[model samples]
Target: MTTVRLPLFPLNSVLFPGLVLPLNVFEERYRAMMRELLKTPEGEPRRFAVVAIRDGHEVASTAPGMPDPTAVPELGPTAGFGADPARAFHGVGCVADAATIRERSGGAFEVLATGTRRVRLLSVDATGPFLTAELELLPEEPGDGSGALSEGVLRAFRQYQKRLAGARERTLSPGTDLPDEPSVVSYLVAAAMMLDIPTKQRLLQAPDTASRLRDELRLLRSETAIIRHLPSLPAAELTRGPTSMN
Candidate 1:
C-alpha cells in the first residue's frame, strides 16, 4: 500500500468521490493551508484530504463571540480517540483536488474543489499551522454483480428523485441524466440523497461499488416510501445535493 502525506480539512459532512466541494477558507489554520497549497507549481494537482468529523464533534466557529479559534479541538475524531489526531476522524475519507483557489479580502480563500478518490487516514499531524495526514489511497473496486446493481440503483434513484420532487413541488433536476457506470452511480446517489452524516459516511466507507449501491438502494426505497406517506415535507428536508463547506 502506498502512503502519502497531504493537508487535511475536516468537515461536519461526508464527501464522496466525484462530488463537488466548495469551501470558504476563513479560519487562520485553513488560510495557512491554502497558502501552502498555492505554492504547488501550476498544473500539478493541488490536493488535500477531507475527513468527516464524528458525531458530537464540532468545528469551531470564528465568529467574534464564539470560542477562541486556537482553543478548538484538533482536526481529528474526538469521541473515542480523545486527543489523538490520528484517530479523531473516521477511517475513510475522500481526497479533494482544488481546481480553483481564489483569494478574497482579508487573506481568506474561496476554494472550489472536487472529491477525486477515497483514502484511508493513517495518521494526522497537528503540529503544523493546519492539519496534515498520512493517507493510503484506496482503490475503487467493482464488486461482484456491480453492473446489475447499478441498473437497479438507477431505477430506484429515479423513483427517489420523483418522490423528492413531488415533496418539494418542483423537479429535482428537471432533465439531468444520471450516469450508468457503477461507481459513478453509487457516488451520485450517495451525494444526492438527503441522508445524515453517519449514513453518508457509511456509504463513503463501503467496501466496494456493489456494497455502496446496495446500501443506497435500500435507503432510496425507504426514503421514497416515507415521502410517499407524508403529505408534505419541510423545505430543508427536501433539499438535496452537494453542499458548500465553511
Candidate 2:
C-alpha cells in the first residue's frame, strides 16, 4: 500500500468526490496545517484523508460520569460497534485536495475542498491534538469513465429527479435543477445533497458508479413514495440543507 501522511479533520458531516466542503479552520493545529499547505507551490497537491471519528469527542468532558452498568446481560450478542471503537473503520477513505482556502473575518480560515480520489486509511495518529493518518491510494476501476450510465439508467435518473423535485416543492421549493449531463459528478452531488452523512458515506464507499447510482435511485424513489403516501407529513421532515459539494 502507498502511504502518505495527511492532516485530518473530524466533523459530523461527510464529503464526497466532485463535491465541495467548506471548513472553518479555527483550531490551532488545523490552521498550522493550512498555512503549511498555502506556502507550497501551486498545483502541488495538499491532499488529506477524511475519516469518521470512532470516539465520541476530541475534548474530553468533565461532566459527572455515569455509574458503571449494574450487570452484564446473561446472553449478550457478540460485541458490535461499541465493543471496540478502535477496530471499527475499514482501511478505506477518500483523499481530497484543497481547491480554495481564504481567511475569514475571524482569525480562522474558510476553506473549500473537493474530493479527487479514494484512499485507504492504513493507520492514524493523534500524536498531537488534531487527527492525522497514513493512507494508500485506491486505484480506479478500468471502466471508471461515465460510459456505464446506459440511456435507460439516465432516463430512470431523470424520472427520479423529477419526483425528487416534486417532493421538494411540496415542502419548500428547493431549487436543485437537474443537470443537463447527468454525469457521475452530477449523481455524486445529488447523493451528497439528498442523503444524510452516514448514507452519503456509504455512497462514497460504494465500489463503482453503477452501485452508487442504484442506491441513489432507490433513495430518491423511496423519498418520492413517502411524499406520495404521507402527503400530510410535515414539510419540516423533508427539509435538508444543500450539500457543500454543490
Candidate 3:
C-alpha cells in the first residue's frame, strides 16, 4: 500500500468511496489548508482525508486565530463519535478531492469533494496549518461471489426502499440504479444509508465485497422489518442520502 502525508478534515459524518461530500468550510485552519492545496507547481491536488470526529465539537471556538468566542449552537446530538480526538478518528476514511468550489459572500466557501478510495490513517500531525496525516491505501479484499452478492444486495435494498415508501405512505424514488460491480454497489448503498459513524466505518472496513454486501443485507432487512411494523415513519427520518454536512 502506498502512503502519503495529506491534510485531514474532521467532520461529524462518515464518507464512503464513490460518495460526494459537500462541505461549508469556515474554520481558519481549513481555510489555510485550501490555500496550500492550490499552490503546487502543476497545482497540488485539492485532495484531503475527511475523517469522522470522535468527541470534540466540530470546531473549537477558542482554536488559534479566533477573533472572538461565541456560544456554540446546539447540534441535535453526537452519535457514534468517540471520546478522544487523538484516537477518535475512524481508522479507515475516504480520500476526497475537491470537484467544485463556490466562494460565498462571506469568508466561508462551499466545496464539493468526491470520495475515491479508503485510506488507513497511520498517524496525525496537528502542528501544521491544518491536521495532516500519514495515510496508507486500504485496498478492498477481492472475493468470488460478487455476482450473487450484488444481486442479493440490490434485491434487499429495493425491498427496503419499497417498505420505506409504505411506511411514509408516499411515493419516493423507486430506484438507486446502482452499478453492477459488487464493491461499488456496496459503497453506493452504504453511502445512501443514514447510518452513524461506527456503522459506516465498519462497513468501510469490511474485509471484502461479499462481507460488506452481507452486512448491508442484514441492515436493510432489519430496517425493513421495522418499517413494516410501524404505523408510520417520517420520510425525513426514513429516507437516506449521500450529501452530508462537514
Candidate 4:
C-alpha cells in the first residue's frame, strides 16, 4: 500500500518503465518542481508522475508563485492540460525518476527522467505551488505462462522490425535482442513502432506483462502483413524476408 503525493507533468508522450526520455522543462510550474526536487538530500526519491495527454497539447502557462499573468489550469483530471484533472487525463500513468536535473542558461531546466513504475491517480489538488496528485503504486499480477509463447512473440516482432528496416533502407529497431522480461520487451517494441496514440496508451495500461506481449504480437503481425503485401515497396526493400500476407 504505497501512496505518494508529487508533482505531475502532462505530456503528449507515453513513458514506460525501463525506458527513458529527455525533457526540456520550460514551464514555470515544472521549473518550480525541479527547484524543489533539487533541495532534497542525495538519497531521496526525485520523481514526478507523467500522464500522457488524451486530447490536448503541452503549452507554457502560469502557475502559482509565478509573476506571469497567464492562464491557470483548472483543478481536475484534465487539470494538467488546463483540463479538469478529473476527466481530462487517463487513470494510469508512469512515475519518471529525475536522474538528472540541470539548470539551463535560459532560466529553464533540462531533465532526464526514466519511467520507474506504473501508478494510478487517486486524486489531484491545486493547494500547492504546482499540480500535485495522490497516486498509488500499480503492480502487475504474476502470470504463469510458458516460454514458447514468449518466443513466438519475439519472432513476430523481429520479422516486423526487419520489414520496417527494409522499407527505410536502414535499421530502426533495436540492435540487440530484447530482455527476457516480458514487460520490458513489450515497451521496447512499442517505443520503436509508430503506433497511434490510443494503441500506445493501451499498451501502457495493460494489466500484466503477458497481456502486453500478446497485444504487441498481434500488432506486429498486422503491421508485417501490411508491409509485406504493399506492392509499392520494391522486393529489395525488405531487410530479411517478406512476411506472407496469406
Measured by TM-score, the strongest candidate is: 1
Give lDDT tens digits, candidate 4, residues 56-120: 44332323223323433333223335545545567788998988999989868878878888898
* Of 2 and 3, the candidate ranking higher by lDDT: 3
TM-score of each: 0.86, 0.66, 0.80, 0.79
Q: Sort the predicted structures by TM-score, highest score first.
A: 1, 3, 4, 2
Mark the regions of model 3 whose C-alpha exceeds 4 Å error after superposition: 40-44, 55-85, 167-176, 231-246
TM-score result, candidate 3: 0.80
Clashes of 2: 2
Q: Model-by-model lDDT, in order?
A: 0.80, 0.54, 0.70, 0.69
Maximum-lDDT candidate? 1
Error of 4 at 51 (Å): 0.6
lDDT of 2 at 222: 70
- Listed per model in order, the count of residue pairs whose N, CA or C atoms clash below 3 Å is 3, 2, 1, 12
lDDT of 2 by residue, 111-227 (tens): 778766777777666555345777777765423444444333455544444455554544322344434343454345454345665676676677766566666666756755664
User: Candidate 3 on 101-133: residue-level lDDT in tens?
Assistant: 666776666788888888988987755556788
TM match of model 1 to true structure = 0.86
Tens-place lDDT per residue, model 1, 1-246, is 988899988776788899888887766777789999999997899999999877664444424224334443354223223577665578899999999999998887989999999999988887777788999999999999999999898888777867766645454453667687999999988987888889999999999999999999999999999988756544445444434544
